[model samples]
Target: MAVTKRRTRRSKEEARALILEAAETLLRKGGPAAVTMRAVAGNLGITDAAVSHHFGTRQELLEALLHQGGRRLKDELNAALKEWRETKPSIQSLVDVIADVYADGAYSELALQLHLSGWRDRGSGLLNSVVDELHAMRTKAFAAGGRKRPSIQETRFAVGMMHQTLALDPLFGEDFRRSAGISSADKPSIKQRKEMWGAMLRAILEG
Candidate 1:
């Protein structure tokens, strides 16, 4: 006789998490096109309507994933900054800390997909809200590090540029830069790019 696995009941939160995890996995493996309710439901051994009950639509599910992913990234950045502050605090340290976060391979990969999808389906507001929140977090982090307040416009601009560069790098960074003969020797690795962006941000915000 073959043993059959028992189906255990899950709480609402657990169910939502499972669905999102399935969807995220699909996204990572096959991009947005692969993330459909039916696919996610099948992955979870549930019906499409069951998954729909949690998110109503695929866009809603994607929005939830973006928010969740953004929060995780922000938390990681905050933790890195906090750990650095414990030793010594400075504007340079701030730059180094966040640059490392940008260079973080796993986070960067997932984030690139989520961001591309966000751009693909514009006007979601989820991505924009997260961006605004990240800006606030950076401002607070700067204050905590004893740097003069950064200007709102400059900070936003710096972050926007940084995100665009960081997000697109996986797809177009090497090829585009190589073709253009952009100096490969000092091509501002992720950390260096963040450092430079940070310095520019500091000058604009602290001046």
Candidate 2:
């Protein structure tokens, strides 16, 4: 006699996580166009209506993705902060750590998609809150390293520029740079670009 196999039931939280994970994978594989509710539902062997029950609209799903991305980013940023505290913060280390955070193609592509997909109308508040939190962390990190913390306004400017570069790189980074006739020597890698950006941010913070 064979034993019956039981289907594992997921709690609402677990199901929601599953849905978002599926969406993230799809987004990574084919960008935003492939991350519909139906697609996510199919990925989890559920119905589209079930996904809708968890996320009322496509915009809601996208908001959830943004939140998920934000949490992951926070974790990594926190680690970077810890590392900065342990070691003397150098421009190259800062550049390397920041480059690691933003280097995930899926994360950066989804970020750009969220911005372009009318996040302003849908869930800009959520994204803005995340940005604020990250900036606050940056301030704390600077203070930890005995560096002067930048004003909130200056901090916002520095972070905004960094975010913009990360978001656009996937869409038109290397190709655009090459098309503009910038040689490899002139056009630096993401890590190198962040070195310059880090220097600018450090200057603002120190001033």
Candidate 3:
């Protein structure tokens, strides 16, 4: 049975955007569980039914938000690759992009929720687009005849480093910051990130 929602059709886009904005805001202020359709609608001064009309359900809305974030991440990564591939790309540029990709404060906040959501919903596929994009870039790099070519798995893992950089180990934020050194501290900084990328990438390309 095809069920339909009741609401003015004018707010479809606005509703979706508002839902995501609310979700993000919720995650930033509290965490994922704090986000609710009713709360989001209230925040936007809209009705719950209106929000539901655009998202279908709460789960759908969360997944859609992740998917949207993933697509934008992939786009930025692809653009960075395009810039790096021109005229003997440097490891620094690659690392810079990696670091900068998730360095945005907005993404950082949303990413925490996505990770938590992934545990409960393994099939989110929010990052499928980004996963595919990474492979495509690796294939192109190898096909270029003179650049580095990492195994598809290796490419994905290297990209995963961004998440790892954000995760850190054992130390809390303040502790980590206090003990931060060149490589450790640099990994998180956009500037140092490019340097790391360049060095790691150059090694792989030369290998």
Candidate 4:
């Protein structure tokens, strides 16, 4: 007779994380439509009721995933800022960090789906720390060079534009580029576009 293998039990947090990971995998594999409760449960070898118990509904799961992405973006950006403080300021580095998070297109697609479903960010100010740090960095730089410092409004506008562009690029960048006369074969790669944005932002900040 063969012995049965026992399934390891997980804590609530662990199970929730695994469920989110499964949902994210589905999202990456088939975009937002793929990330359903059934699919997520199947991916994790869990029952629909189990997933519901953790997240209540698919909408809540998607919201949690988005928040997780935001937290990752914040952490990576904070790390980049720390490095910049140790060395010279590199706007391109910062741009690349944001681009990396949105490069896969999964997060962008998820965000669009949630917005279409009437989900809003609720002004959680997830990026408020980032905005504050960036403004402080710019202020220090300008003071060091004896130049006029950028107002907080200007900094906020610049950050908003940069973020919006990256967030939407995965969804619309190619189409927009083609519409602007760039051929599919001739259009810049995502990395190149990010670099261009970095240069443009640097000019705007340093001008």
Judged by TM-score, which candidate is best?
4
Taking every candidate in turn, the Cα RMSD to the unseen true structure, in Å, is 6.0, 5.0, 7.5, 1.9
- Candidate 1 ranges beyond 4 A from true positions: 1-6, 89-152, 182-207
Lowest lDDT block of 10, candidate 1: 121-130
| Candidate 2: regions farther than 4 A off | 1-4, 121-152, 175-180, 183-187, 203-207
Which candidate would rank higher by lDDT, 3 or 4?
4
* True-vs-predicted CA distance for residue 52, candidate 4, Å: 0.6
Query: In candidate 2, what are the lDDT values of residues 20-119, reduced to their tens digit?
Result: 9999989878877788999999899989999999999987898788778777766766666667668754545544554665565676766667778767
Backbone clashes in model 4, listed as residue pairs: none
Per-residue CA lDDT of model 4 for 1-207, tens digit only, reads 999999999999999999989988898899988989999999888899999999998899999999888888889988988898899867798889998889989999999999999999985555676578778878898999999877988887888888889989989988888888999889897768987999988877766
| Candidate 1 residue lDDT tens string, 29-65 | 7766788999999999899999999999987887787
Against the true structure, candidate 1 has what lDDT?
Answer: 0.67
Model 4 segments more than 4 A misplaced: 1-7, 144-146
For model 3, the local distance difference test gives 0.60
- Candidate 3 segments whose C-alpha is farther than 4 A from its true place: 1-14, 25-34, 85-88, 104-153, 162-190, 204-207
The Cα error of candidate 4 at residue 148, in Å, is 3.3
How close to the true structure is residue 14 of candidate 3, measured as C-alpha lDDT? 69
Candidate 3 lowest-lDDT run of ten: 166-175
